[model samples]
Target chain A: MTEAVDDATLVQMFETMALVAATDDALRAAISAGSATLAYYSPRGQEAVAAGFAAALRPDDYLVTTYRGLHDQIAKGVPLRPLLAEMLGKAEGTGRGKGGPMHVSWPDVGLMLTTGVVGSGLPIAAGLAWAAARQGEGRVTVASFGDGATNIGAFHEAANLAAVWGLPVIFLCQNNGYGEHTAFADHLRVDHVAQRAAAYGMPGVTVDGNDPVAVHDAVSVAVARARAGEGPTLVEAVTYRLFGHVFGDRMTYVDPKELEAAWKREPVTRFRQTLVEWGLLSEADAAAIEERSATTAAATLAEVLELPEPGADEVLTDVVAPAGADATKRTARAATKVVVPDGSVEVSVRSAITLALDEALESDGRVVLLGEDISDSGVFGVTKGLAAKHGADRVRDTPISEQAIVGAAVGAALGGLRPVAEVMFMDFLGLCLDQLANHAAKLRYMSGGLTPVPMVLRTAVGGGLQVGAQHSQMLEAWLTHVPGLKVVVPSTPSDARGLMAACIADEDPCVFIEQVLLLSRKGVIDSTPIELGVADIKRPGADVTVVTYGRQVHQALAVADALTSKGVEVEVLDLRSLVPLDEAAVLESVGRTRRAVILHEAVVTGGFGAELAAGISEALFGRLVAPVLRVGALPAPLPYARGLERLALPGPERLLEALEWVMAYEG
Target chain B: MLLRLPKIGMEMTEAVLAGWLVDDGATVVKGQALYEMETDKVTNEIESPAAGRLRRIAQEGMTYQVGDPLAEIDED
Candidate 1:
């Protein structure tokens, strides 16, 4: 039994629920008729949850929901037209036809993400709530899930974390009598799913989910408690899903008698009855509300149907944020140049990095640097002179929390700052990948080409220095797999300076990798400028092309020198940029030589060398005298022993071996 | 000839001017560091790329921005 809400508000809630239910039905019909023939999970009976939660939340409060989230999305302020357009998979949809039924996200109106996975939203919601609480933004997160999610690991983990952190979150569970075809009694011992909340040290309440007033009152209390920073509360609304799990479910497990009884307890009917008993609405007025809802839904569907289909070019758009032809055009225009200023001496890689940072800060006011001890000595003194020159305003030190550092950098980049974030070592990149992959890489594309997040990640890489297993892994191949990111690995000190300068200037996100072994290596550098996406040919020969990057470029150059002495002509190509790879250059060089060897510092299996070999093979299939060969570190954890370590890496001897093999082979 | 010390005194008679931040005959004002010089530790500013007529009495890598008279600037 639950206390009753006011009559007038209860009627309004019921009207909203009915409108949402009608919208869900209309959307399903529209989706089926659309070109994609998308199937929708209509929230017909669970409309009370939406009506209840939406009524309690302010516009600023964020709401995260699962796939059966049409009602919740609507309640959170997504208009009927956009919702309809989304279901129709139209360009005007919330996700610009990118995300279909399963992925509905509206950040503008506070719908964080409505995922297809049953329990994934729970953890994401908890994260949002934690961010809100930490920032003291007075925002609360409402995570709506179905009874099936209660059994998920994400649900438990999220709930436990939220409880421990005392995050401002509300876990709303719509316990419809059955989860898909399985009945509640068949799954768990507890009569009410809300009883499980006590195990996490939080208050749980079970309400008659069919009654809009009961649902509203329960949600209002939970929302208030969350807003007050009293931590999370669980609310289980016991209701019956009138329709099958999805549009085509037969609902064979539902008993005929039980189905009829459940229909009588429909939230719409119960709320209307309560409203009539309290004399808040006449029969005619209630009938008018239903009529208006139907009219609105009809109008929405008509508008969606009249919309044009996405053009062919629209297919590639919104795949990354700031989606436009300009992205590709800008990427095309960035060419790597070897800039060598007269009388300007060539410096060590470490000194060049420090000089570049100093020059960049002096040149651009928007540039900022953050990492552990970056303001102090920058771990390797690469940023040592920066703090003294720029003061601590532009140079910042962060706690050891990789997630926070990366997330903050993403935020700052979004706020229009060129953030150069250092991950100390390339091996530690694993710790902050969520921000890199999910937020930084996906935000632009996910937002339908609206947001452009520009950031530069500076990391030290390679394994030759005896730093051992933890500190010495090169994982550039791992990052190159992602689409929206550009990676630059510079072999020379001048390349480090010039590439770093270009990365700061580029509009797209880039990863600037500096090899640890080359930091102290000195070389003569010309004062010409360098750009991204273009490879430099260090040595010109005609027999075989040795394509390499980072520290391996030196090795390949050495092998080329050795091969030339042995009466073999080998050309050395330095792939300065990984993404938007110099495919044309590679093909041209390999075509001339009619043979190729791809060399890198990463492990052999699934390395960037494989991609290079495949590209070369595809373009120069007939032109090649031999198949492109790959030379990379052996696929094993780097050992501590110097001999073993030397054996694992692809050095000059290894490159010579690979070159000799490729030269002997006849395709 | 006019020369001002770049920083506080040293027993050294001359300093090697690394490079000029501004070109010769460039308008320099009083108190501006026109040229850069190197000590054993780091580089320091020579004098003014000033409002007066500029002159270079010191050659790069051989002259000091401090101890030696860098140049005589004619004030207009």
Candidate 2:
């Protein structure tokens, strides 16, 4: 063990400790001076833990940390100027003033992420390690989370996935005695957090975090094991936090005696004494090292304060993947030649979905799928026979952990694989929306366009199944509301096969919502791809324009058929892609018909239909033959009773009633 | 031979005889749609079993439990 810890290595650790302690001092000074107002998390007492681990990590290795990770970020080689600039909301910041101190990321230096959410970085670290293993590069990844994060599902899921896949990663838990205001003993059930690692079939160790030498040796051994491809190890470093959770937080929650004892073993002072006792460095030399770090920090802060703020044009720069990617993506797709089966014949939406998955699997070696029962043919049978055809490695079955399923997809996509993950039902989205909304939707924009998530989250949605509130509901509006997400809801079997091809090939992350009732209806399809965001006029007429999507498109078509003989001509417009919505097609139809009716399966209060209705009212003012009408689900939750379910869903009968109301109307 | 109502769902113990496309003693072909049956949430068309004369044993709008005979088709 001493072999991993030589005098040179200890010196490097000592230098890192001084630097981190100095950076902390500068940050507190800036906060006190009113130059920086962001709530800071001072890792003042835990500097040695980061210092030792940073010394053990190689230059090319990856590390993901938390909001309270300024010490680790500096140790991993990120320049303090950019990091501090970000905190000061300056244009020269790490994320150009968008990411502040809590989310500073410098991937070029192997500091991949510093997420604000607790415990969410574990799965991403697993993905990085897996990518390195796949490339045959002998690199390892370290994921650092707080002790409170150990109780989160992402921590458990990532640990199990890394062990099962034999990924080269290390799970580092910084047990700083307190998580926010709650003490470790009061929050955790186990005696030590490392004891939780045995359940995932990995080695766990507890180390004295204050001792820089001991922490360095333990991390060096773990890194060596991971580089040797022996898989991940969990290392719990026990330390204390001198400051409260946030900068302005008061100390009323902590016991003064505990705080006093922790201060006695402060890492910088303890390590400096060790260095002097070993005769490796004099007291004056240590004081000189501290002075150098303080001077560098002060100079960097002065430079950061002079940088300019971002201008108004920054409002819409990095929200989605950049333009011109579509052309390149389409050109690449042409090389795929994904042969849709029996192009001459028609099939059901369920069969179309299977064909799409099969095509994507055959065309690209980078595409993979993972879900709860997908390897077992899936509950909806959308992935039926895919495991047999593509093998279990590409079509994997996961434990019933939604956060992990989505988190791994985001990470794997960043790691160079296009994952098509399934959540079985839309209601289950509640379990993993944080992964979708926070990570997948915002990664590209927040990373300053450096990272683009090219993954697809496929889930079945509808209310006619009688599966009760947990399994039945239309929640597509929730996804469409997010800025960086691509929302795809196909109405026909052909669109199911075609739009999925386009969505899977696109560079941005997408939410593919499959309507369950439409799965059994047969429609025409071919290998010719359908363009995304291009609305289709399913049925054309002149008197009224009926705008809808997904299952409601079928109702609109049926309404057109029933009203043809009643002297009323109707037009049906299906908006396939909701995010990049085709407003021109909607306006053209409304202008021709002079009347509009918006329909959807979600509740009317804040549905996608309302967005269309409001947009139409503004764009086509004074051109309407009558007021625009909206027919949607009732405001209440969908019940299990058949009668209530039928009433709750607006179907063909409801569409006919709406048509009558629009026809017998006055402008 | 008698034609019995088939079970379609996990919790289904009975079905409604919604309507019939064929009349009593009507000669129908095998696998032809003979009637429509309604479960609690869905309505499905029940197909014929044999190419023969269909004898109606149950009236429309009436409830029929599982294993109950709906009609008998006499073979040629």
Candidate 3:
């Protein structure tokens, strides 16, 4: 009941699959030999889908995949050396040793992004396709996921969006009969995952996943249709997972009889038999293919083993850009302060921010602001005048989609624009974390110094405005935890202006957190230059050092002044930046004062203050006269009531009390 | 030379000069606040451009066209 094709090309496809299987074996061997700590997701029996899709694709078409991407990547022309280097975490890896097995990417060859998360790559692929379509470049996006991802929200959302927009995207589902250890039948109700595509108003097709020719034909048609602006297609290729889910997954549920049938109908062997019968190639040719593949794999493994480790500076350079490029130089020069008249006048922080943006926009053509409700004076009037002055193109008003706002900014940055994306409130950062942490932070390093994303993320933090829990939150610690990101918290209007200017000028991605409570608080703002990693000493003392930042800086300064009157001589240090943190200043100040008190408005549990206290204890143990005391908000949700909120957050009085306790305590 | 406020709105044709900080012929630097004006929602200071002598054309409590010369600066 099936049509049989000729053997020659089928034999070649079989040979390629064999080679891929051998590479997977080599990866497992490399891991067992203790030469590498690799997480190998073997596509032992399910090789037809990869061979089919890869054969259909041109070198220019993009492929974004998930954790089980080894076969697809290799078949799509990724050299074994770099992939092995990545598995080994060597500098020569596809991701420069930063992304191990799961996060492999080859941007040059058009494999834009890859991930370990099951369905997250789908939306990203849709975005890339959208960009390519807007450029009219005729590049198609191929995103592959497993049967498990069929139920994920991102997969459906991406499918609906792609179909509705008629984007040039191909959604490939390699239904390997199992998601991890669970059988597909137990989880999915439908006989075919492709049948679900009708809901998105797109054509869906089911192919014989074990047959390379069938897969090739289906994918070629989908690719062509996508290129012709026909829309996206979901191709469900029925296959089986031959190996355990991971390196050591136990095969407890697999039936022996079913396994035997799967082995007998193995795609590589069946295709090879079909090829030999049709006289497409001789037996010797197939043997030669196997021999050549082994030799190539061995050579690649040797080359990767010889690659050197990444340097120390490599960890810090790629968050935005390194210091030599034209963009970097321009940013550095712009960061330097120009001579201007100064006076302490009454201006709200919101107004200062608007003025800074206006000045930056007028001064530089590359600077643009994008966000939701930004055109309508923003939520708190921070970007109130921008849209009217710069027009909608520069100050874009986006839909209520945080992910799209951040992702588009990343793409725009790659296209040579400095975008400052505002996420209204800090609490909403959770909605767009993938764009921030994964794409923007990792793109430069993953591309191996090829691309840099210079973007600024401006958001308001703290809880004193009675905007409720959803609006007011001090979530700077979450952003600071990620490497390659620069975190800044400015407490004064002058620092807000200067630091924002510096952030706009820097080549790295920066998260500028402005405390909402301090928007109305007034202070003397000296027009001094503020660098990214430098801490400012607000007051000099001897008994104890009170280290803090953001809204807590004012409280710490007041506490220091109050303690000074009592002859305690407490020093106050305001940490302007969180990442590339001024650890030296903290250590030096704590070492000199012999006692330290860390304060913050964020919750006490796992707050940045805990890290500071631990660092001081580790570095200045012998010099310290007492244990480092941490003063932070109570370990509970911030209350809405003014009095209750005051009780929850650390105030000047609390800092003074903590300083007194640290000053008198004998460890 | 004609002095005008940068394009701040699509429909705004004129703005009222609420107050002036410096007297006529006073030198001003770029980005220095020369006068204050009241918009629909808030009061904002209009900064000066170029270092020169400030010549006030519109007095306080008066309005002028968007691009009309509110003041003239004679470069040294």
Best-performing candidate as measured by lDDT: 2
Q: What are the per-residue Cα lDDT tens digits for candidate 1 across A246-271? A: 65354667888898888887777677
lDDT of 1 at A336: 27
What are the fnat scores of the candidates, in the order listed? 0.00, 0.00, 0.00
Clash totals in order = 27, 0, 2
- As a whole number from 0 to 100, the lDDT of residue A415 in candidate 1 is 43
Off by over 4 Å in 2: A1-3, A334-338, B1-76
- TM-score, each model? 0.66, 0.86, 0.73
Off by over 4 Å in 1: A1-12, A28-36, A126-137, A150-171, A175-240, A253-261, A321-447, A450-544, A557-572, A584-595, A603-606, A620-626, A633-649, A662-667, B1-76
lDDT tens digits, residues A230-253, model 2?
999999999988876875344677
- C-alpha lDDT of candidate 1 relative to the true structure: 0.74
Please say which candidate is ahead in TM-score: 2 or 3. 2
In the order shown, the candidates' Cα RMSDs to the true structure are: 28.5, 26.2, 27.2
Tell me the lDDT of model 2 at A267. Answer: 92
Stronger candidate by lDDT (1 vs 3)? 3
lDDT of each: 0.74, 0.83, 0.76
Pairs that clash in candidate 2: none
